[model samples]
Target chain A: MSTNDPYDFSARERDILRIVVGHIIPASAAYGLPGADDGAILADILRSAWREGRKLHEAAAEIDAASGGTFATIPTGEQATVLQRFREQHPGLARACEVVTARCYYRDDRVMRSIGMEVRPPFPLGFAVEPSELDLLEPVRQRGKIYRDAN
Target chain B: MVEVNEAVDVVIVGAGASAAAFAWSLAETGMRILCVEQGDWVKADSFPSVGRDWEERAATDFAISPNVRRRPEDYPVNDADSPIAVANFNGVGGGTMLYAAHFPRLHPSDFRVKTLDGVADDWPVDYATLEPFFALNDEKMGVSSLAGDPAYPPKPQVMPPIPMGRSGVTIGRAMNKLGWHWWPSDAAITTQTYAGRAPCINLGQCGSGCAQGAKASTDVTYWPEAMRERVEVRTHCRVSRVETDENNRATGVYYYDGDNIERFQPAEIVVMASNGVGTPRLLLNSASERFPNGLANSSGLVGKNLMLHPYAQVRGYFDEPMDGYRGPHICTWSMQFYETDPSRDFVRGYSYQFSRGHGPVTAAVNGMADGLIPWGEGHHEAFRSVFDHSAGMVSICEDLPEEINSVTLDPNLRDSNGIPAPKLTYRLSENTRRMLDHSVARGREILTAAGARHITSRSPLPYAGWHLMGTARMGTDPRRSVVNEWGRSHDVKNLFVIDGSVFVTSGGVNPTSTIQALALYFADQVKSRIYDLFD
Candidate 1:
């Protein structure tokens, strides 16, 4: 699917993207916003990701080239196998994932402002200033547990 | 030709929180009621998350009237076309469809703040009088909370408490340790399945509109029930005036249909549930020579004493990512330090509700360094860093009623119907200003106790229109208030104004629950033949 489209996602691309976002933000699980069967919003994100040239399948291709097996063809469980290696070994992939998720989740900067919040960088890393409180206990730091059972 | 509409026993205006409840209460009376809603109907399946495409605009109603420009005399604080500053939905449920559903009752002490604390005017009725109605509102709205907690009055709750995440627990623990009272909020959302609706899935998208049908929006609960009882909901109709006879008996109403065509419908009575802003605007425009000041304004108190629940936020970043952004919008209670205490410097109190973070787009706007320029990569990174790393508390402060703060007709501006819009002039009182400072200090202290790495706080910049209330106050005296204790216009018989506009005082909590309770009570009063007092 073309990224220029408002919300377009391929099935395979959506499945992997949904699980990744669910693992990254786990709150979506509490609202039942993201379940294994619910592929709607997840599909949109993946489509947007592809349009942005940060396609998960393509990124998986790079990971496959660096490691051995291709990421696109791997089974659900095996997909985790490939990502786990990079989360631990490839610092670049971990940073890239963080960057990608932040950009995707906070796409509506103007909407957020209407409600009295601004988006800024994480401080030192970037100087974008949105007024927000810092959270020390972010679940993403618990990276050892791949694919949290919930989201 | 104008669409001469069908007649009903009562013609109600607006479909937000107040209007929905009014329709729900009056529907069972077997009276032919017509509710003219300005918004359309929205169901759960039509929400953003459940749509066929992720960004199909997702059933959102953005109703910015293009043709109408607000005159300076009409909405001095806003653009000509944007006389009303509130972001309301153009749907069947109105703002109820989009609200976060935080249901908190104004404390008993809230009723007599003026007499008790010497702050503002006293409510014509006390909390004890309205307590039964409050319970009634809780039952119908499906409020979820453990009510036996001594902090609030004894009331029955339908849904159980929504589980607070680590952030709520941390704040709860920290606040309790400080000898403050905090409980799970009484939100009008189903914690478990009730009345054909599913339990809250905790998607934290309460603000965006609940797709799971868990939130107790009027459209899902009251409007449907009203529809079953045969309350006719007319969408896309904007009511402009309430026609009254020389005796001041409400006869009918005039409005514009979807096509901007003027239409008139007669009725036995008129109930203005058009909320704080809309109600006052209508009254200010319904001016005739017989009632030169305004409709039902014999005492000239129709659009005076306007108030809003001025609010601010205090942020706290803990050592761990509390993941505060993951659950319902407001899952925890507030510290009632100044709620009833007579020892406080301020006359009224303020309450706080804990909040989670927003999505990336929202977060970016929030991270837009409070006083910085609009753009840059540095801005983008700042937004990303705190993507999942923030949580805060919202402080809803009670605004003291001031005669100077008001909504009046703009002499020059006109709405789409060629009727004058309400021009508001408001400023925060010195006492409220001090209260904001005091609450910010208390918020910072609590965040510090919770071991926050960074804490930030904000206060309203003077007259920031937040919680609109008290424009047409209720009291026995026609000289001071507009409506009587029963919300019936003291000056005009058969003309009743429900909603936040009739508030004698703006309490330190959300007005939805209280307003719903008042609507139920007034409906019962009308049903019980007490309205004959005027006849």
Candidate 2:
């Protein structure tokens, strides 16, 4: 997989990922900048793959080929459907997302935070609170609300 | 009747920095000199052109080849062919051909380390004695630096200093805001059109053999001038042993020529400027029946009290374009807090050097990730923005000498020549580990202040191959050191070892400038016949 080439996502995968990352690190519509869902973050991650000597294009192509349709062709609704099916049908995507979300958050979050975008959430199954008390950043606690405050 | 070989006045081993300086100085005396180099001759044109995105030579060990770089079976530290942990340049100027050209002198207190911080033993000679030699070395090397920089000790530079770029300016401002001391770094590069050489063009490829001849890599400066004076530089000749007589007076050396055949060359005096690791290994290999241990092991200090400069790195990603990977490898430094403070955990201090960020290829491997939808238009956009938005700095630290951190020959392993391999058994001191932790935290703070998007760093540890020094130190006492103040071994009269191996303590500063100055001083002592004073 050549990490340098732009990932040719199926329409469905593109729509879902773009929307997911936009919401993960939501972009400010008031700033006149493109929303995080504009696919900039995904493209940048693919470019980083190339820098790392990986074939992002090939990896994407394999996923596309396995889905029996190009990733760019699938709709966001279909991408969400295929991903849920992917969780049941294929083990690779499930394992890959498990690792990628945990690792890329620290490295990729800086730019997202700078531009007022939140990284998209991944694998909600692993999101349980730890036994210890949570220590959230002040700005995050005040501004970033993941769920409705019970109070 | 046996024929007597032609006698050279002085035979120097290893055509590295010190050897080149010694050759140039001795050539001025009109003495017949022969320099045997294990490497080939390299010229400025030999370097890869700047226009190309180049890969380093595999032989130079710059790439990531796990098997080829260091073979664990034959050599524990490195490979059989390149067994020593030290970086090797098998060309005209040795490793100086690929150095980053960041040259800072060890302070006066660095020499008297034992007295100041109460750590290692003090040098036989003080900074005052070697100050004149330092000026001579600076003048000869065409060092570019400025005076009145409060960050470092008091020493004037001969040439005008290089301009600090945007990254240096940003880092400098941030350091000041945080109450840290910083200054324009002293470099061994020609900043102006001085001595018929062009000034640095800021290609940022100084580590990979400068093609412009602006960087002082001995070949274009001292070695060429020495050649003009009729000094014979025999390249591709590896000196195996420095042969001595029954009376313990120096004779000459036996070396393998370009061919595998061995040849014996006789000379009056022998000088070994073959770097820190190689010099000690050569000495240990020169064990004769008369000298039961090694050539200069009367005090059993031939290869004891080894030291290495432990370094840590901090990388920052900034919003504004820093243009960091565009200038010289090093042009700015922070030496304001160079003196030892008892409040700090470490006995000695460390200097923070602002240097080149990772190039494109390495950054992708280290910076980018898969989570952001690797399959699409998003990947291309991320690649373009991050390349220009990165900045980084390095911490050049001082490591106190420990007797346990010694270089011994591996009993079971051997090189291609069937020679025993040098085994480096070194671990970081508790003080050094603590120092690294402090420096990394400080670096993180600086990056955050500079508005870094995110910062990441490895825990502080001793990295191999930046600046290795002090395997064989210099002192008056035979039991404490291997060489005297002039770099001549105390046990042997005519055998001199001029290199970083003669450093008494691994100062926080880079040792190249001091190494060159000490080499010039050793040459002066030899030329003026100052042995009478010593006797």
TM-score (all chains, Cα) for each model = 0.74, 0.75
- For candidate 2, write residues B94-210 as lDDT tens digits: 667778778887777787777766777778776777788888878777888866665444677778666666566667667656766666778888877878788776656677677
How would you encode candidate 1's per-residue C-alpha lDDT over B1-535 as one tens digit per residue? Answer: 6556667888888777777777788787789988886656765665654422222131122222211212111122342332224444546765566577888887777776666777677787777777888887777778888645555656787767776666676776677557566667888888778888887766565665777787888888888888899988888777778888877777888887777788888888789987677788888778787777887776677767877777778877655765534567676766455465557777667888887665554454345434221221243334345555667787888887878877777777666557776667777688878788888898898888877777877786332343578888888988888888888887678888888898988887888888888888888788887446466
Tell me the tens digit of each residue's lDDT in model 1 across A1-151: 2243424544544544555554443333222222212344344355445323444554444455543544455665665666656666754554444434534443334323432334432211211212222132132222222110110
Interface RMS for model 1: 18.6
Native-referenced TM-scores of chain A, all candidate models: 0.40, 0.38
Q: In model 1, which regions exceed 4 Å deviation? A: A1-151, B1-3, B51-87, B340-343, B371-385, B461-466, B530-533
Candidate 2 CAPRI level = incorrect
Lowest summed-lDDT stretch of 10 residues in model 2 chain B? Answer: B51-60
Worst 10 residues of 1 chain A by lDDT: A142-151
State the TM-score of candidate 1 restricted to chain B: 0.91
In order, what fnat does every candidate score? 0.02, 0.00
